[model samples]
Target: MTAQANTALAAEILEVPHAEAAAVTRDSRPLRLITCGSVDDGKSTLIGRLLWDTKAVKEDQAATLRRDSGSQNDLGLPDFALLLDGLQAEREQGITIDVAYRYFATDRRSFIVADTPGHEQYTRNMATGASTADLAILLVDARAGLLEQTRRHATIASLMGIKQFVLAVNKFDLVAYDRAVFDQISTDFKALALSLGVRQVTAIPMSALKGENVVYSARSVIPWYEGPTLVETLELATLRSGQSTGFRLPVQRVSRPGESFRGYQGTVAGGAVKPGDSVAILPSGQVANVKQIVTFDLVRNAAVAGDAITLVLDRQVDVARGDMIVSLDAQPQTGLAFDAQIVALQPDGIVPGKRYWLKAGSRRQRVQVEPVQQLDLKSGKWQSADMLQMNAIGKVHLSFDETAIFDPYELNRGTGAFILIDPDTNNTVAGGMITAKRTELGGLNAHEGRVILSLPADLAEQLLATELLASRRDEVETRRVTTSAARQLLDDIDG
Candidate 1:
C-alpha cells in the first residue's frame, strides 16, 4: 500500500474521551488477558495498537514517543512499539524485556492486557503474564507463519489455564493480504491448540502497523474477512473462574480479639462455604462444622470465591496459618511426594536433589526437586534432564519432608500452582504447577526401551500406519477417550 492509503487508514481510530475512568456499562469485571508470540512478531506493536486505538495513550506520552522514535513511519504513526518496551535495556536493544501491563476499556467492557516478551530467553517472563490471564492473544507474522517460539508461547498459555485464544495473524498488509497464507497458518495453529487441550479459538488476519483489525475492523481492506476486531473478541470472551472445586480457605491468620471469639480468616480460594457446612482442616485430618461466617460488616451466611471472611468452627480444630480448610467430600490432594511442571526463572537454574521452599497458596514447605524431563518446545517431546537451565520448561518430582497440599492445576489454578524460592538468597527460582500425586517408586515413569504415547485417534492411526508402529502393531493398544480424557492426555505431554 502507498503512503496515501496508509494515511487514510490512520484516520479511522476511535478515541475514548479519557483513560482514568471508563463510564462504559460493564457486564463483568475487567478481563485479564495477555499478548505473546515469537520475537519481532509484533507483540509490542499489537499492544501499542490496542492502546492507541482505545485512546489509552496520553497526548504527552504520544508526543514523547514521536520524538524518541526519531521519525514517523509511512503511515504517519510514530513507531507504536516504542510506547511499550519501557525499560532502558529494552529500548537500547529494541526488545521487550519485562512484562508491561496496561489497562483500557471500551463501551462494552474493561480489559487488563499484559504485553509479554517474545524471545526464548524471556520465556519465564511470558509465564508470569500468563499466570493471571483469562485469555491469550497469540500473534503470528503473516509472512513468517508459525515459528517455534509461537508454539512455545501457546504451550505456556495453555498450561497456565487460558481456555480462550485469539490468533492475530499480524502484518497481513505486508503479505499482500493473501487468503491462502492466512488460512494455512490458522489451520496449523488450531492443530497445535487442540494438541494443547485448548479448543476455543478465533483466527483473524490483521496488520498491527496499519491499525487494521486490532480495535478497528479490516473489512474495508480485506472484504473477504468478516470477523470481529481483536477488541470485540476479547469483550465477548469468557472469564476464567476458580470456583469449580470444593470449598478451600487457606487460613491466612487466626483472628482472636477476645478470649470468647476465635475464627479462621482468609479469602475463599475456591468453591463456597456457609454456616453448618462440614469442613476439614487439611494435613491434620481434623474435621469441623462452620459455626459462622464473619466479615467486617456483618455475620454473613455464605462466602464464595474472592470473598474474604472469617470462619467460626463449631468445635476447636488444629487450624492455623498455612493449614487449608476445605469441604469434607471434595478435598485437595495431600501427600509427601507430587509431580509437577516448572519453568526456571533465575540465572542459577534449578539443580537436581536441591531443596527449595515451595509455596502454594498459603502453604509453604521445604521440598526437594528432582528433574525428570525437559520439554522440547519445537517437537512437543519430553526428554530426560537432570537440571533445568534458566527459562527451561521441565517436569520434576517434588518430595516434602512432611505433608503437602495441592490440586491439579487443570482443576484449580489457585491451589495447584507454586513457586520455588531459593533458600540461600530468598529469590524465586522457578514457577510450577502440580500435575499429579505419585503413587509409584522412582522419580520418572518409564517403559524401559519402549515408548508409549496417548494421542488423538486420527493422529494415532497415522502413527500406526508408519513403519515404526506398523511393524510393532501387536504391541500397541488403542482406546477411545472421552473429551475430558483427551484434554488430560494433552495436559500430560510436558506439563
Candidate 2:
C-alpha cells in the first residue's frame, strides 16, 4: 500500500455512520454489576481487590483504610472488607449491612460494582442492587461449597433477569487450592444456574484476600484452573442490551416552565421516541402527537431508552406524574387484575386479601393481594401458600381498585415492576413483577365478567344467535357447566 491508499482508508474510517459508531460505543459502555453470596463469602474482599488492583481507590482513601484497619489478614493486606463495609455497625459486627457501590475501570472497559450485603437480613438490599445490574458475581466459600444463602442469591439474581453469572469460589487458599473441591463446587453451581435458566455462567477459583484470580491471575497457585480472572470475565461480559419492547416514558412530572412551554419530563423507560410520533397517555387512552423532544442541551430529533428528556406535545392534554407516555401502536396491558411474583421483605410477611399501596414507576394505587404460592428455594417447587414470610419469594394475585398499567416483566422490566407499600406504615414491604393479567372469566375470549346459563344445549345455541347477545358477545363471558360443578363453585364463593 501506498500513501494514497492509507489516506483513503483513514477517510473511510472517518466516514463511519454516526449512529452505528455510537451504537458500538454504547455496547462497550460501562457494565453495571453486583456482588452477592452467603455471609462471610468474601464479597467485599473481591470488590476491594478489584478496586485496589485497578487503582480506583485514591491514595487518601488508602491511607484512611490503613488507619482504619485494626488488624491485617494473613496475606499482609488491610482488612479489604473494611474498604467496602463502610458503616460503623458493619465494621463492628464484621459483616456488610448496606449496599456499597464502587467504580473502577480498565483500558478495555469501565465498571460500576454494587457490593451487596451477604446476610439473610439484608436480602432486600441485594435485590435492590440486582435490579439494575447486568451481571451478578455470586461468591461461595471453597470449603463450604454451596449453601442455602448462595442458592437464594442466585435465585433472586436470576429472577431479576440477570443472565450472566460469575461464580467466584473464594477462599481457595483456605482449601489448599484443591482442584477436586473447585470442580465439585463449579459443577454443582452450573447445575443450579442451568435450573435457573441462566446459560451464561463462568466459574473461577480465587482467594480474594490473597488477590489471586480476582484482578490478577492465580494460574501458578491453581495450576489446574485455566479460566479468565474475575476482572477478565467482567470486561468481556455483555452489557444489558436495549431490549425494550415499546416506547415508554413513565411521566415523572409535567413541566410548565412558562405559558408557551408545556412538557412531559421523565426518563425513557423503553424503546425510542421522536417528534411527530403518536403517543398515548396510559390509563386514560388519550392520544397526542409529539411536537418536540427537548433537553437542557438542545432540541433532539430522537431519544432512545435511558435518555432523560422533556417531551412537548402538539396539543394540551391531561398528563400527570405516574402516567406513562407510550407509543400508540404498541400499548401496555391495562386491567384491574394481574398476577405477580414478589419477594416478601417485611417480618410480618404478606397476608391474603390485604390491601396495600401498589407503586409502579411513578404511580401508586390501592391493591388487594392474595398469596397463591411460595417458591421453595431448595426444591425449586411452588408450594401452596396463604401468607409469605420475610425473604419468601411468592406468587400472588393483585386486584387493583382502579385500572393498573403494566407490561409483563419478561418484556419490559421498567414498566412491569412494582413495589407494595404497607398503607399503615408507608413502608415498601415487597418488590414484585407483573407476571400476567389474570383472565378469570373462563371463555374462548377474555371478558370482564362471566355469565353462566343452565338452559338446555339447544336453547343455549339459540341464545348465541340472538341479535342482542350476538352483538355484545365479545364483552361478556359464557360458561356452561353441570349443575353439580356449579353447586361446588357456588359453595366455594367468598360471599
Every model's TM-score: 0.85, 0.81
What lDDT tens digits, residue by residue, belong to model 1 across residues 289-354? 999999998999799988999999999778889999999999999888898989999999999999
Model 1 steric clash pairs: none
Error of 2 at 184 (Å): 2.0
Model 1: runs farther than 4 Å from truth?
1-25, 440-495
Clashes of 2: 0
RMSD of each: 8.5, 11.5
Backbone collision tally, model 1? 0
Residue runs of model 2 more than 4 Å from their true location after superposition: 1-28, 443-495
Candidate 2, pairs of clashing residues: none
Clashes of each: 0, 0
